[model samples]
Target: MRAVTWALALWLALLGGAAHGAGRGSAAEAQAMVGKAVLYLQQHGRQKALEEFNRPQGQFRDRDLYLAVFDLQGNGLAHLNPRLVGKATGDIRDADGKAIFQAQRALALEKGRGWVDYKWPNPQSGKVEQKSTWLEKSGDLIIMCGIYQ
Candidate 1:
């Protein structure tokens, strides 16, 4: 009886962990996050918006999905990673050597909003994976959010 109970408990724990890990955000959710961030920027202003976006624990962050913002000059204005906040991310490339930030900049400047796909390390999964980022131009900044595919 003790052995059976222990096995059932372990099974339940494993099942719960799997269910918790399955809640990745969708593409639509990523797009919606971008829009919501834009609205927050408009209402609360840039400084506040950046603070919220850069915060690791906030409404803008969900599972592996979070907001990333860059200045017109390609400097990281807001990101969950503190090290990336003030650095130039435009020169960063993907696993395939694709210019990630340059493509994002071009799309935002030319079309004012669009999707850019690249291979990046998913923070939650700790693996390099395909991702689609939806971005928009908001004043002097470009707001973005992405989903792992």
Candidate 2:
């Protein structure tokens, strides 16, 4: 009975550890996908860039991916989500949205790349969601990508 109890506890602990590790790995992979996508956009320019963003390929489309391009002054230029192409995401003004935008700007200036995890407001649902943002700088433009993990 004592050996059986110990074995059961050990199995449960291993299972829990595996679950936690899996979650962390998934988040890291999502982050990498965002990085790759941003890099691709930086090298390709807008005309050829939209094609990469249009589809949910491999691990990218596994969750919701949002990409936006902005000028240095924080004005949104284009978005992967066609419906929001002309919208002003910077003026979103809400604390979370503003912070994410600011972080993206900072990253572009500092390392030529930036990333942060935050909760974003979903326009359609009006609900807040946990997401990760990746920013890359290419000449005069900044490309920002958000992945809902």
TM-score of each: 0.84, 0.57
Measured by lDDT, the strongest candidate is 1
C-alpha-based local distance difference test score of model 1: 0.82
Model 2: per-residue lDDT, tens digit, 50-124? 555554353234334455677777766665456555555554434454566666677788898655556776543
What's model 2's lDDT at 37? 65
- The deviation in Å at residue 30 for candidate 1 is 0.4
Number of the predicted model whose TM-score against the real structure is largest: 1
* lDDT (10s digit) by residue, model 1, range 1-149: 13643353345344543422456766666778999999999999988989899887889998888999999888999887788899988899999999999999998989998778889988877899977788999998999997776
Give me the runs in candidate 1 sitting further than 4 Å from their true place: 1-21
